[model samples]
Structure formats: structure tokens, C-alpha cells
Target: MPSLTAACATPGMRRLRILPACLHEYRGFSALRPWRRPDAVLGWGRKPTALKARRFAARHAIPYVALEDGFLRSWGLGVDGHQPHSLVVDHRGIYYDATRPSDLERLIHAAPFAAEELARARRCMALIREYRLSKYNHAPARALPAGDRPRVLVVDQTAGDASIEFGLAAAATFEAMLQAALAEHPEADILVKVHPDVVAGKKRGHLLEAARHHPRCRLVGEALAPWSLLDAVDSVHVVTSQLGFEALLAGRRVVCHGMPFYAGWGLTDDRLTCPRRGRPRRLEEVFAAAYLRYCRYANPYTGEPSTLEATIDLIADQKRRHAQLAGDWVGIGFSSWKRRFVGDFLGARARLQHVARPDDAPPTAGIRRLVWSSHHQALEALERQPPAAPLWRMEDGFIRSVGLGVDLVRPLSLIIDASGIHYDPRRASDLERLLNDTTFSPHLLDRARRLRQRIVSAGLNKYNVGTPAAGLDLPEQHRILLVVGQVESDASVRCAAPEIATNAELLRRVRAAHPEAYILYKPHPDVVSGARLGQLDTEARRLYNRLITDISITALLERVDDVHTMSSLAGFEALLRGRRVTAWGTPFYAGWGLTRDHGRHCPRRARRLTLDELVAGCLILYPTYLDPRSRRLINVETAVGLLEQQRRTTRALPLPQRLYRGYRHLFIERH
Candidate 1:
């Protein structure tokens, strides 16, 4: 946990030894003693400084280690915050382009694969195959060639890339490979798949103009994932590209025109030679050496060290979330600035179209309309003249426990889906459907349970609004009941809370039910910020033992025996934290055999559900999430982690700004 310090060395001198700092910022290790320096030093690649560091370490009689990324990266561009899932740290030399018998070559040749190691390799490979996972999780848009004319995929790498520069390929090698493929597979359908960097305009490739016009050859410019591209092709042609190795993994015939890392291993058809790797290797043996032994993985969300299996599952989940978010363009009715939060979650691929009125509708092909159920005009118009686009009812998510002291608080998350909104009783929602229809898989249930544990342990709330617990001195014998208040005008209360119409009525009911219990009343954040109505007067407030405001929902949940609510998300958040929840209305979390439901229960929801099933449906499956700061789509786990970080560090607005935002909210509500 020690910060890198100049004091570790003499003034203006370089760091004598590299500290064992985590490649990711979220992880940490205690500082090593000055006298007990590392036996070796590690570098990602053979950069100039790395060589110099090696020299320096050698002079000090310390071994030097070089490093590089392993396979299976991420869906995002690595230009920003994304880090690699795997890295190779070698004491013999750099792995990718070692001059003479690198550590990887030694390991692949001499290392023995234990039975358990082989089993792990098999498991990893199976998961990759089942998920269709690749370095990048994107799938190709190109359709598979029908009738099987023997398709050959010629993989193109960025010109002057490390693999080409270090291995047997050059700048003109890609063009030469393309021509060779065309000549050899004259009757075959030849498709040239470009590297991701080329498609993203980060780098250029060799054969675009000529390859596009060839009669039998087609140039694919899209940045589709290589694994998906490999599925449609019968054979792969590469010059020292990783796709050649991946081709062997996919069980496709591979033709390596140059001496790539995987060539000469008897697994590939090599046109070139690597005499050092003369020994034959099974695919699993090669896999075990390259992946299981040589690489280390870290959790994408928490940045803690992780297993390859867990990492694969997370990547699959993230990729699925990304695709769902980008499904279609979204048109929102009666929009506000906060609607940007919803739009952000949908991501850049899904364009946001503002519809001020019904007449302002745009093209409806593959379009989705987001309607707030409270807006009667927009809702009625949609019902009367239904658009071709699907309906995505939008609302706040369960962990929406935070708001700025002012009304300008940005949400940590929002829910937008094709099914009915969670609060509305007019139609069935995605959550209701999943609860009714899903036969829980043990693996998914286990994942959900682990996720729930992390959320609870981290003390993460919906908005991650930072509020400390109140230091309360309670009568030891009194039973504590937390009464959650909500906006009476809110859709959830109006449509679901038939018995308790107002905050006062909710309080009255809780008090009447437990006359001897100590009652703690908490007004909704919206009401407290003056963005909406429903705050109690002094006399009404006096009915409760204490009116809590300055405490966080997490803190309240810990102290209370149970929570009483008229269909507020606070009840759901409390449930996640292991608090007893008594639902006065049929909120989405109720009727699932989890909460104590006093309202209507659907007959379809007769199946007993676990905490993970509820979490999987509500948090992971039901809602789409975006990192508000980055305005990009993210997975549920990442959303929770980011919210927790934001909660701890976020600062409130100044008095003037707070007053202005409060006024704005009040104006909007009054209108």
C-alpha cells in the first residue's frame, strides 16, 4: 500500500528496484524492505528502458523479467481505463520476440503439464468455445458463406505491428500473403479480415484498394472479433499473427506463411521454419503452457487478481450487456436533462431522439420509445396510436438511494426495458416475467449470490450518496421499525400503493401496527430536495421517535429490525443488505417469496426464489447501466463498484447552486 517515493533512492537517482505495485490501481501490496530487494525485475516488453533496466539489474546481480499481454482482452478500446486480463512476466527474457530461447519457448518445450492443469486448460477452452469469446467480444456482421465453396480467411495485421516487426513478417508481407491465398485457393472464397486497429483508424493495413475490387476476394473492413470471423471460414492464412494460433484452437486448417510463435509445433501447416520448436505439441499442452502457467488475470471491475474462468464469465456478461444496450435507437417522450442518464446507459450506438410531442415522432424502424408512466399525455398517445417501435418504460432502479442535497444529483443507475416498468400494475415487467418464468440455474444463482455478497460487503447503495450514520442512543428494549416515505405523486405509489396514498398515511399505518415499537421515519430524497411533494409538518413528524435525514440508507438498514414501505426501492436495497422487508404494495421484489407481501401477489410467482435469483433478475438482467462519468455502457458489477467510489468521494454543490437546482426541480414538478 506504500506510495512510490523519491526518498527510496538518493536525490535525482532512479528507483533502485521496482516496487511490486499492482498493474491496476484498485489493488495493492505492502512495501518490501530496502535490504530485501527482489531477485528479479519484470517488464511488459523489450522497450529501450526495459533493456536498460535489465542492464542495471544485471549490474546489481539481480535477475530481470520481461512481460506482455495474454489473450482475451475486453470489448472496450484499451486507449482509456481498460487493462489487460493476462500478462506474462519472464525471467529468461521477453516472451513474444525473444532473440535466443525465450522463457515461453523453454516452458512450452520443457514444462510438464499436470493432470489438474490439463483439466483447467480443457475447462477454459470449453467456456471460450461455448461463449464464443475472443480477445474482443464483438461478433462479425458478415454472414457465413453458404454451400461451402471452401472459404479462406487471410488475417491482416497493422503495418509495422510488433508481431510482424519481431517475427518473420514485414510491411509488404500482408499483401504477399493475400496474393498467395488467392493463387492457392483460386476456386475458394477469400476474405481479408483486417485487424481492429486498422478498422478503428488507429493504424493502416496493406491491401485495401486492390483487395476490394478482386473478383473472388472481398475486403472486410469491420472490427469484428477474430473468434467470430474464424467460425465462417474453413482455413486461416497468417504471417506470425495470433489468429493463426487461435485458428488451431478452433480446429480449422491453418497455413502459416511465416515462422509465427505457434508454427513448427505440428499443430499448424508451416511454410516457414522455427527449428528450435521441432518437438510436437498437443493443442491442450500448448494452451496449458501459454495460458495457465504464463499468465495472470485480474477482475475487470474490482481490479483484484482473478481466475481465468471467473474472468471469462465476467467478459461474457459484459459483452451481453453491451450488445443489449446497443440494440436500437431510443426515442424519449417528455424528456429532461436527467433523461441523458437513460440515454447514456443505452450508449452511443443507440442514438437518443427527443420527442416533445406525439407529432414529433421519427423513423420507427428498430426504434424504441422511452415513456415515463407518469406522463399521461405521452402514455395515452402511445396507447391510442401505437408506434411500430417497442415500448421501453423508464424509471429509477432499486439502489436509487442517493440525491445531492440539491435537486441536481445525477443518478447512479436507471432502468429502461421493453417490458412494463417495475412500479406500474398495468402490464407485466421483465422482472415479473423472469420471476415467473425462470428455472434458476445453479451456476448463475451462485454468481448472483457472490455478487450480492460483494455489494453488501462494500456497503454500496444505489446512488452511492455519501452519508454517515447518526450516532443514536436508543432504549435497549425497544424494537426498531424503519418506515420509508415516498412521493405520493410517484408512479409506484399511485399505481401500486392502494391502501397508503400518502407519506402520512404510511406512517399512520406503521405506527398503528406497532404502537410500542420505536419508529424511524425517512422522507424520500426527492421530497427532501424539494423536487417533489410529501414532507410531514412538525406535528406529523413529532408522531415518530425520530425523523432521519442525514443518515445513509445502508446505515439505517443495519440498525433497523425491518423496513416498512409503500413500494419504494429502499425496501429492495434493504432486502439485498439482509434486512427484513414488509411490503405494503406489490413492488417487483415482492411476491417472489422473498419479502413479506401484504398486497396483491401474482399466482404465476408461486416458485420459491433465492436472494441471487432476485438479484440476477432485478440488478443484472432487468436494467441497463452506464458509467455516468464516462457516459458509456457498463456491466452491473462495474456500475456498483463505480457508485461506491463515487459515494465516498463526491462533494455537494454550493448554497447558490443548490438553491438554483432546487428551484428548477420545483418548477418542473409544478408544471
Candidate 2:
């Protein structure tokens, strides 16, 4: 019987050779024989490949056409429009989807004849020969300086996927290990070589900047190959970089701090464990298992054979495809699934509903009101758009502020004082003077004189509804509104400031709203007791009795129906506990169409929502936290704990300068 290979023989059709223009430009086509003809040329994005292909075709007097998924789809012969597919063209300029037999038949029928197709096939073969992979065996032999100390070399490709941001912590750990190793082997010379591709300026500077602080660390930003560096060093240290395996090939010791694909392979000493474990194997064995056994890394993004040498080419191809089909990419399975499964899909849907229908929404009758007093321009911009809930402004006056809470004024509405107050920097001086004064400590004061005059002048005497403790006995189901202010004369209602006097009227309002609600007005933690910039001339407790309610907010919130505030996190906390949040001012969470807005019209007013959605939006989506060293997103739990601790300790929690530097490097400088 004839050999089995003879059964597969067919005439006329031949394998096509596709060569990128860069191949001819760099490596000449001297190897191509006349018998092998070029069919159609292939290249990357629209600009370079198309231009080069056209030039080659013009020079050779052959027909050339651009290869693209969109061009194929225009002929109504492509798959899914966004699916990764390839094209083949004959000598007569007939094109077909090589992946499909029907497309090939169509091309054959549409073309002149089999002779022309064969000629195109021969041309492709000629191009393929020109682009054949060549062996590179010019690496130098391993060498190290004669010494008892170990020589360490750190290697990594600075370009592509190697990022210092994600690997900074591991890099720091490796640096520490390297230092310890250097101390143990005092004569050891540490050499850090940058990746040649990276040194060529394809990416930002390598991890050298992060490691520069160490005296022993050095950056080699030249065209030195990683393999050459590996030959010189006795050992290697890495985070999850590919150089670890390359160093293994060079018969060097490797210490890994992160779970690179090579980790747990019994060869290198990995400091971290792989979260997803498989059958244990050696380092080489893992590489074989990944590349040769289990994983077949075809270009899933472009549906092409993704050889290691052509990986970058395939990536460029896919990137071009992504750019071309940018809008359609969103509707694809992967992106759609991410938005649905990993994100707040339900909340997004609900928000969409709220946005679509605003007329049927119910009124937020019982929320607090807050006003922006100083930044009139900012306030005007915010007020132009109706807030999701009701918010009262300072222009509405104190009577309207109290009316939101008063039972006789408005039964179901919660009252929040939106009057803007001034934040005075000079108050710090008066506070220091009052604290040091012998007779007038914060605990003692003459309320009949100065305190009474200030309250009477401020028109707060009428809103005096007695202490929160005293008001609890009144036979009315009411909610108290606490107005917390920032600085004394700043005039803007900020929650994070250090003054309590500006918030005095808010505490008074809360006392009037909920006689039973224990209205506790705690001063800002930043403010030291007995420190007064101005004299109230009354003991804090006595003034509490004479001018306003003596209800602690902690106790009041416990029994109250809801909280009212202007952009305060207290409203967030209240919302977290299932208490109705009447935002009398605009907070980050206000316009999300979740909370009750007192400032503008309520669009999606009556829709009851889960607390989780509100929490997810505010806590997860709105704020940005930076890792102090890398300036990436900080751990949320860690940030919350830090904020809580700072609140308790009353110490400054300034962001680390390194984090700011990292931010500048990553965002501002890159842009």
C-alpha cells in the first residue's frame, strides 16, 4: 500500500504565505525562490501594514488588498462582526474567510481560475519563506567573579505587562531579602539589568525608581540582554516576573516572592503559595505543563495561532480590531457579563429606572435641610438641578428650617436647618486664651451676660425648645435636626471642619424637633476643650440649658426616625441603619436618586430602596483612596479603619507624600 500521506494530496490549491512588511524591511527576501509565488500580503493596523503591502504589490506588479474583519463583514461573510477571524486572498484578488470552507469555495468560484489561485498560493509560500523563524544561539557562557560571596542579578522586562504598581509590595519584599542576602555575603555584587525592550523606551522606567532608595541597588538601563545578565549572576530574585524561569534555565538559584506560574514547581523557593494549586512539578515541568500540555495560548482576541515570537504582532492586531469595533465590544459576552456579574447590575438598573421616570416619584417630606452659604456660585450650580430629595437653603430662612420639623408647621416633614454659617479662623486664638484663663474654664461661665446676649442677637432665642433631655417628656412624636458646622467664618456648611459654635443653631433645631430625641451636640474632636477664640461667658452645660437643647446626637439618633444634613457622612451612617435620610443639602450620595433631597425637586421620590445600593454607590464608587506608597486604590477596610482611628485619636492623617508622588508619576506625568 502507498504511504498514508499520499491519500491527502490535492492539486491546484496551495498553502499561502503571509508576511508582515516589517520582515521584508528588516530581513530581506533573498531566500524566496521564483517557484514560490506570493498570493496576498498581510499586516497589522490600517496604516503601516496596508501601506507596506500596497508598496510591495506595486513593486511586484501584483494585486494587493487590506485584510480586516470589517472589510469581510461588509461583504456579509464574517462571523459575529467582533469575532476573531482571518482572511485569505488569491492571485486574482479574490478573498475568503480561511476558517470557513464555504468562504474558500466562494473565493475559488469568484476568482479567474485554479491557475490564478495556485499562483497566489505560490506567492504566499515565497513570503512565508522570507519570514521563517531563525535560531539564536549567540548567548555567552555563565561567569561570575571569584569570591566566596554570592552574586545576585535581578532581571525583568520593563515593557509590556510588568508593572511596578501591582508588584511594588513584592518588589519591596524582594529588596529586603536582597539586602539580607547581601549582608550575609558581604562581597556579593548586585546587578540590576533593565529589559532591552524596556530600555528601548517602549514603556515607563523600570522598577529602578522604586528600588533606588537602597544603597546596594543599581539600575542598568542599557541594551544588555537578560540572558547575559543571567549568565553573570549566581542567583535571582523576583516577584512574579518571567525572568525567574529564564534564570532557572541558566542553572541559577531563584527566590520568588509572588506566585508566578513557575512557583510551587519544586525548583525555586517561592515565598508565596499559589492560590490555585495543581499537581506539583518542577519549574521546567510547570513551563512544559502550561505551554506544552494544558494551555494552548492561541490569540483568543483575534483567533490566530499565537506563537511566542508573534505574540506582540497578534496583540497589535487585536488592539487594532478593538479600536475598529470599539462600540460593538461593549455588547460582547465578556464585557456584558462583567457589568452584570461583577458590578452593581441591579442598582444600575434601578438608577436607570429613576432617570427614565421622574414625574411619578413621591415627595421626601421628612428629611433635614442644609444650605450652602459662602460658595454662592457653587450653590447656584447645584440648585439648578433639582436634588433627588428636598433640601432647604439659607435664603429660605430659619422659620422655614424649623417648619420642616415642627408638628404644627408640617406634620410629616422632617426639618433640617440649611442656614449657612461663617467659619472663623480667629476663633482658635480666642479658644486658646479662654482655655488658659483661670476663672473662665470651659466648665464655668456667666450665662446671664455674654452667652444670653449672643443667643438673643442671633435670633436663636425663639427656637429655644429646651434641652434634648427635657424635651423627651413632651407628648409628641417628632424628629430632631442637628446642624453640624465646619469653621466659624468660612460660611460654607462643611462636615469635616473643627468648629462647633457655628453648629450651635443646628443642635438647637434638633432639640426643638425631637423633645424626646436626646439631642447630644458633641464638639469637633479637633477642637480642644476650654479653647475658645471668643468668650461665651457661660459654662457649656449652663449655655446648653439657657440657649438650646442639651441632647447628645448619639442618643438622639438611637431613638429618632431619621437624620437630616447637608453633605454629612452622618446622613450616610443614618441611611446605613435604615433610618430615613432627609438630605437638606447636596452630598455625594444625594443626586444618585437614592436619598431624599430637600434642596431641589425630587425626581424618583417615592421609590423605596435597599440600604446596600446606597452604601455600594457612596462607599465603593464615589471616593478614591490611594496606597501610601504606590497611590493605587487602597484597601477599603484599611482606609475605613484608619479614618475611624483618626477620629478617635484626633491626630492628623495626612496622605503620604510617596503616594502623591506615585499619583503624579502614573496619572499626571503619563498624560
Candidate 3:
């Protein structure tokens, strides 16, 4: 029997071979190539060929070597008559040109080639099972901890210059925080693991030399798999690190310095303060609210479902490629889309899963009933008011309810209008009951209605209104064109006709503009609540209200154009109803080159547009959604709730300076 080396010396053998003869031969014979070294044989091929060859080598207990270049030359084969070919070998050490018809005839005549190939296939199958068993075995053992000392691991991949400055700053801040925390807790050992790909020189290192100077800090350069490190660490600290949330999944405490989406959840003690005042909720509740009510994950670019893992893989690959081409040191604007995709979508999902999932038990009875108070006025009211009393206040130019007790329940949020004040306390009672039965009470609905009436009457009087009305009265045929705009003094942008501006503005504007059209003008809901405009005196409110009879814009448009605004959200509501909007000043939906911009460039207003293109841009773009109080990403609904509460009360809570100071000093200052 000819050995593989001996058969290689035969004429036309190499030329006719297509797949690497070594790969084919290794697939068949186990005993024949006892001296065939694992590292010496180099395989050259395309990605698919390499994958197949690697998979085969992995199966046969043979080490696979990759050739960076010279695919055809290394294979010792060529195209024959414009057709590709391959070489195969049997366990008996017989070689055959897979492409040549005569080769098969010769092989059958020589030995049991079919039997040999079958044996090789069986071995490959066995190898696959063996590999899977080893890979999926119970997670690897964690690193041994120093006695009586907590172990902290900080994982990041920015030790290389190819990373952007932000990445470097993030890495540095983590290192600093880890060292500082270690100093505070001398018994803790701080372990910094460089990313595996970076250690392999595929990316830059995340740790610098300065990071290692701390006596307690140690840099683990080798690839110590993620699960192993996560298991070993007592707590994980990160500056927007994905591993921080991953640690949370494994039941480790996480301390975040940056405004990672996870930080606002009530699970971890956030070093940074959330901007809006919201009830501290269980992680599961937050997840349910965010996913069920507020957010959806689709492909950032396509608005389609791409699995989370696929998105992460694409982002990781793109980052690597971008770094290589651009030589790193990029700015926020350069990678804003990628950052938004990761932070807004991926990070949010991870936080929702890890932090929001309920632990084994239900929430405590007391916690379920608690409503977070936002301002000092609310706090003061809570302290002074009766246990079950309902109260409202003007805080930070918004109306807010104060106090929490068995009877002090908020039903559906109150929406006051000219017809009368209305709120479905039953709906709120149902929702409260759904969240927790112990906190729900039917009497709370009665208390809420009475409280709403009091607040409305007070608000109307404060705004110098003679009566408390429930709903706006407008003609059925009138196309209610709610012109939402920023009022400069509350009086400068009033209607020209008192009836039209008051209750008949829509009718008057529509009739004027279309001569046959009817329009209605409704005062902004914010103004009616006596929020930001509550400071205005009676003369101001009356003068402002009367001025509705003189403003020329409605007369000029010659349409029953009702001026309506509820602190700008009305613009969105009006747009939803397909009403034409005219701006007195720039609102968020104004500059999208979408609506009729009476203030700026109005190019070809004849073209009709889709609602998505207009609304998505305003809600998803324009406003940064920063919590003005905390300067963090404002949870949209929470912000809206707080703003509403503030408009009702004169007393407001001061910003949480301590939280802001800590966040800036630890994360933003270093970054």
C-alpha cells in the first residue's frame, strides 16, 4: 500500500486533485498518518471551504492549520479542462483523482474504498458529539478568590489606540472607579480582564498601564471566558459596559457610573439620579411597562424584527471594520447611529430582561401603594393634608397630585375642558387593583372626583375665569384646526373673534377662511390648568382671553381655525386627527419640513405626506428627552406625568444635585 507521501509523487496526481488531498485523506484514514503533525499541514481555501475543512479536522482529532495565502499552489492542484477536481485517499493509503472517471475504476480494482469512507464518516459523527458534550458541560470553574475578600472584575476592550476617545475615556473611568472602590474596600481584589479579541490583536486593549498601578488591581490578559469571570466576580462595575447587565443576569450586584439604560430601574442603587419623579417599581414591572407600553425592538435601520444576537454581531463586526478603516479616535456624531442602536435598543432590552424580571416573591404590601412625590410642595402637602385627602399643586409650571394613602387614589388622570372636568376613577381603580389588590379602594374614586373638581375650580379662578366648564363646544361640520404654538406673553397670540377664540373660534376661522368652513379655537390645556401662566394676574388672563377677538392670523387664513394647545402635546394630537396646524412659534413638529410653516420656509404646500414621516421624527428625534431635573434620558411617560403634576402646584422640588454631582465626578468628568 502506498503511503500518502509516496502517492503524492505520482504523475498527474497533484494536477487533477481539487479539494486538498490532505483534507480528503485525513477524512478517511486514522492509522495511516500517525506521524502527520497537527500544526504542519496548512489548508488554503475560501471561507466555506475553510469552514468545511476546519469542521472535518475538528472531527478527526486532527488540528486544522490555516494558510493566509496561496490557495491553488498549496493545494498542489489545478483546473483540468475548465472543470474542478478533488483528490481522495483511503485507509489502505490508496490515492484517487476524484475528477477522473478512470480514478474510480482504478480505486474499485485496488481496494475497499467504500468501507473506508464509511468508517471515516462514522468517526466524524462521533467527534461532533464529543465536541458538543465538552463545550456545553456545566460552566467552567471561577477564579479562586483571596480569603475574606470580595472579587470585582471590570471587563472592557479599549486598551488600543484604534478605539475612539470616548471608548478610551470610558475604560479609564472604569479603571479609576474600580481602583477608588478597591481603596475604600481594601479587602476586595479588583480584577481587570482585557477583551479576548483585543488580546488577540484583533482589537485594542481596554486597560492602560496606569490601571495596573493600584496595588489591588490585576490585569488578566488571557481570554478567561465571560461566564467564568461573571461567576467569579462578587460585583461588577462598568461605564456603559454590556457585561454589567450580563452580570446582573447571573445575580451579581452592578454599580453603573454612566447613564446606561439599566441604571434608572429600581433594582440597582443608581449613582446618578433619574430626572423625572416616578414610583420605584420592581424590575419586572418596569419591563412590563416599557416593553408592553412604551417600546418595541425592530431593526434600527429597517424597522423589522432582527434577533438581538444578530444585531449585536452586526454591530461588533461593523465597529471592528470601522476602526480598522478610520484609524479610531472617532467622535460621537460619527458613531451616533451605532451608539443609539446599542444604548437605546440593545441595552434597554438587556436591562428589561435582567433588572425587571421578578425575583421569587411578590412586592411588599407597603411598596405597592407608594406614589413617588416630585416637589417640595407635594411633600409639604403630603405632610399637612389628611391621610386620605386629595390635593393638587403647581410645581415647576405643571399640575401635580400630592400624598399617597388608601383613599388618595388617582383614577384616570384628570382632563379639564369647557364642558366640564372629567376623569374615570373606575378605570384608575381597576388599574390599581390589577397592580395590587391591597392598595385599591372604591372610596378613592369619590375622593378623586371631588379633588379634581376643587383643583379645576381653583385653577379656573386663578386664571381669572368666571366658570368651571367641562368640554369645548364646537360645530360638528367645523374642521377643528388646532394651531399649537409657543405663547410669548399668553396675550400676543389670541383670536380676533371672542366667540371663535372662546368656543366659536373654530367656527369663525373656518367660515372666514373657507367662507363655508367652520373652525374652533381652544385655549391650551396648560393655560387652563394655570400652570406656567398661573403667575399672570386676572387682568392678564382676561386681556389675553379677550385678545382672541383681535388676532389677524385666523381671519387671514379664512378657515375656522381653532387655536388649541395643551403645552404642545396638542400639536401631536391635532396632527393625529389630520387637522391643519399653523405655528405661532417653533414647536417640535414644526421644522420637519412637514407641516405648513407659517413662520418659515413653506415650499410647495400642495404635496400630501404620510403621518409616520411627520410624527416619528418629532417624537423620536427633535427633543433630546433629557430629564431637566436629573439630566438623564427621561422616561417619556414619567416625564409627562411629572410635568402635569408640576403644572398644578406652585411648589417644586429642587434638582437632585448630589446625584448629578456624583455622576459627573465619577463618569462624565473622566470621560
Candidate 4:
């Protein structure tokens, strides 16, 4: 097959989906028509490949719809094999083809946007600006020329683009736009933004030939974020470029030299006019018609239908996580198992080097240091002799996995602490600072509440192991006190619980504290499987009234009224379940006034916190979740949904099939 660029003759078109655009999206429309056409012809907007489709449609008397990329498409470019999240379906004509009325143009002329519609449009616009989002969000921040002069931005587009050819624009039109910008503002510096296609070296642009030599002009060719470019400019000039509409949405002065779809709507200063346009409309009204009514959106991850606002938030979140992890780092003492998955959280832009110890690591400029938090010996060694780079500690998050980590099951979430790790309460961790100092906004609190409800109702826990306690004799009405166990050799237990370090000691203390309460002792799953230390002593069984085994911790939590622990994650789960939690040691979740703190009055945690506030700092904000399928960092809500779906789907399958799938996805990590 011919290369996409070779056949299409446009830079970056090689990565394009290549099938006819708008018409493919209209298959249902064609089917719903009274004529009962089950199939219809589709073509990419004005591409040469669509010529055959047009001929086939004409010959067979089938309706043809032209497909174009929507205004807000994907995070990356269509030419880079990133498919469109949104598509423009035009039956009358494509939007960029100004020779005829397009469906978008018809919507702009006919749609009556009331107050409610306009309000939504306004909010969407505000969020776009607030997030600094553009159609393609993969670009990095730009380093424009430093100056205080007013900037006049001139946009450039790829040569031979259908939008220019059909919008009554040519090489001379770009020249005129550049000249007008320079001539209009005598003291203003002219910023010539080279099109992304041109930057990718797929094609040439028109403005470069005219604006290259001018002392007042500077060519911007880097793959920089377009919103940042718009922020830097006072006014914008364009000929059939979508940046003109974005500039208008951003409240910048836009001058259009050609009759693009947005030009005739009376939102811009236009050099060319289309006589078919209707009454003057506000920016929000135009936006409501174009984005809310004339386009169709799909979730980029699932290809399911989605609203524009939701897609915007999704893109913004992805961009935010990418920005946070975009740097070089040195990894210290990550085991052979963990080495497979660390890169997923570090992001594609980061460069990571693994070193056995802090002393052997080389110091480099602008690089960070990362180490596993549970490696107590290494962490203490690092504290004794610090490395040159800043250190970051990471551990498995609260909602970890379906199976035990000792069984080689990879975690879906991780906690990254720049201060100390969350388990070590001797010093304040980042999670502590967030709880103490940061103000919790209503929106964040609401999100945290929803997340907590989901976790509680679903009976989610640290490891999500076992089924509810069953086939064991226990009292129904009596007050219950559950004692959670931990690995005796674990660093957290050694560091946090100096007074109480074993399961037997925890059980004995719980029985002493609650003399009448029914004491139930549960051992850690790792201990049950003989993977680590901290097995319950056979002689110590007499300390508690009941010994529980072969049951899910989450299910057991519901049977108990109060949970006592020396720093187990199960105590946190019990708190979420509305059971009273008594902390025997200083866990991260304890000392916040939410749990009964018998361990230590650190004096640092003097403030009382609501359940939702505690959850907000611990679950939603502190930890980052990874999508197992895509190997991308996601939020806690998405993580919950993934685990829920995975568990349900695995159970529904046959035993043999489940085993086969498990083998296929054994490692489930990225290098």
C-alpha cells in the first residue's frame, strides 16, 4: 500500500485514519431514513480516496456523507495514528468547503440556543481556557521570544489544504494577513505560528515565505501547546485555520481573511463574506450550535458515546498526570519484578536509570531519585548518606490487587511520597501536609465522597482477597472487636509499632482493652500463605474468643462493630465502613482525630477531620492508579471501575478460560 502522506500529499496525513470521514458517522442516519437504506457510502472530506466512494454512491443511488474531524478531536494528531475522539458529520457539505452550505452552517443558521444552552456553552469555554486545552494536547509548553510589546499572532496552515482552497484562500491571502498585522500595529511584535503539520515536516506553509525576513516577525515552529500561544497574543489573524475560532473563544481579537465556517457567523472581523449566513450571534451561541449540536463525540478510551465536557475533563486529567511525571529520574533498588511497571507511572517523556544503591548512583543535572518505600534497610542507608538528587519514595496504594503481592500479582495503584513514606509516622509525609495545610474545595470533597461510597458499598479493601467470613460459629448480637495482623518483618511494623510488633501481642492488647467485646483475630494473607513472618502463635489463640481464617477481610469488616490494629490498612477500611477504628500504633490514617489514637499524641495532628476530608487527602489526591490495558496513569474512580469490571468478568468465564487469560496477562507491565 502507498504511504498515507505519499497518497494524500499532505504532511502528517500519513497517520490519518484515511477512510472517508463524516459519512462513516452517518451510517445510522442513512439506516433511519424512510427509504430503508441499510448501507451508505462514506468518504473523508475532500481526500482523493473519497473520489471512488463518490462515484460508487452516484452509480448505486446510495446517499453519501462527507466526514471531517471535529473541532475538539483527540489529545494527539490524526496524522500520528491517534484516531479522532469526535467527528463532524456533514450531509449537505463539509464545513471547510465554503462553496456550499454544510450541516454545521445549517445548524448555526437554524439552531435556537436558549439561556440554558448558552450557559452550558459558556461553562465549557471557561473550562477549556482554565485547563489551557487545545484540540491536540500532546505538545509541550512553548518558549516564545521574550518581549513586553503587544503581540499580533498570524497563523499558518499547510499548503494545498482543502479548507484554504475551498474557503477562497491562496498563498496571497496569507501574505495579506501578515502584512495587515504588521501594518496595523506599528510597535507590536508579530508572532508567526507555524502549523503543526509543517512542524512535523509533512508539508510547507505559506506565511514563512513572507514573514521569515521581517525583523518584527519570529517564526514559531516547535510542537508547542496552542493555548499557550493564544495566551501570549493580543490579536490573531488567520485564513481558514481553526485557531481563529479558538482565539475568539479565548476573548482575543480575530481577523479572518477567508470565509471559514466561523467567519460568516459575525464573531470575527472578516475580509470575505458568505451571503447565506443569518443574524449576528454571541460567542457562546455560536459555540453551542457548533459543538453541542453539529458534532458527535466518542470516549477515546472505549469508543463509546460521550459528552464534550466529560471528554474535556478526561483530556485535562491525562495532560496533568503527564506533566507531573515529565522528567529524568534515577531508580534505586527496584527489584526485578517492580522494574517492569515503574515506567508506566513515570510517563513517556521521562528517562529512568536503575541503580543498586544510593552511593553507586551518578549525580546528574535536573534528575530525580526514586526508591521503594518498603525497603527499610535501603531507606535508612539513604538517610545515613544522602544522594545528590532529590529523593521520592513509592509504595503500593490502598486499593492494591485481587491477589497477594507475594504471589507476584502486580498492583494497579501506587503511592508516591516526596516527603517521607506514609507508613513511617516518625516524620510528616506529603499525605500529612495535605491533611494539615491544604484547603479542601467543595468540588474535591464531593468527588472524595462519591469515591468513598463506591469503595464502601462494593466492600473494597487493600488486597481485595477472600470471600466474607462463613461456616464459623460467632455471636450475632454481641459487640465485636476485630484485631488485624501484619508481617512481623515488614518495615512499617518495625518502624511504626515499637510497643506492639506481633499478631499475638495485638490480640492480647485488644482483649485487655475491650474485656467484654468479642475478640476476633485475623492473620495477614502473606502469613497464611507462608510467604512472610508474623504467623499467629498456637498457644496465643486463647487470648481471643475466636480465630478467623479463610475469609475476605472486607466481608469480615461488616460483621465487626469496632476494629483495632497496630497499623494495618484494614483499620482504614473499617473506618470507611462506619465502624469505630482504634489505632494501637501511629498509622498514616490515625492521629487525624477520626480514629481513636492510643499509640502516640504526636501533637502535630491537632486538627479534627471529616471522613470525606480524610479520604480526599489519602485516596483521591495522594495515590495514582494505572490502567492495566493502556499502561497509563488514571484516577481512583477509574481504578475502582476497572477492578469491579475485571472481577465480574473473570468470575463469569469458565475455569479453563480464566486460567488461559491469566497466563497471557501474567506480567501485565510495561518496560
Candidate with best lDDT: 4
The best candidate by TM-score is 4
Ranking by lDDT: 4, 1, 2, 3
Q: Which segments of model 2 are wrong by more than 4 Å?
A: 1-518, 523-561, 591-597, 602-609, 627-633, 641-671
Q: Give residue 547's lDDT in candidate 4 (0 to 100).
A: 68
- Positional deviation of residue 524's Cα in model 4 after best superposition, in angstroms: 2.6
What's the alpha carbon RMSD for model 1?
A: 5.8
User: Residue-pair clashes per candidate, as listed?
Assistant: 5, 48, 62, 9
Model 3: per-residue Cα lDDT over 461-482, one tens digit each? 1112122222334466645454
- Against the hidden true structure, what lDDT does model 4 obtain? 0.76
lDDT values, one for every candidate: 0.70, 0.36, 0.34, 0.76
Say which prediction, candidate 1 or candidate 2, comes out ahead on TM-score.
Answer: 1
lDDT of 1 at 507: 78
Between candidates 2 and 3, name the one with more favorable TM-score.
2
Clash pairs for candidate 4: 11-202, 15-79, 20-43, 20-44, 21-43, 21-44, 21-67, 22-66, 22-67
> Which wins on lDDT, candidate 1 or candidate 4?
4
Per-residue lDDT, model 1, residue 355, is 68
Work out the TM-score per prediction. Answer: 0.80, 0.27, 0.25, 0.84
- Candidate 1 per-residue lDDT, tens place, 1-671, comes to 43322111111112211122223321222222345454444444665545555655667776655656667766565555455555665667555563456777887896468889888898788777766777666553345547458789998776766667667667777778888899988888888887656666778887665567888887777767677678788899998777887788788999987666677778888776776787898888888877777666664444456667776776776677666656665454655765556667665546676767765776565777777656777878876775577777676666553454235566655677677777865578777887778776665677788888888888776655536676765667999989999888877888788777788877787888888999998888767667777878665676689888767777888888989998988888898888899998878788878899887766656778888888988877776666565565556776666666666666765677677766767686678
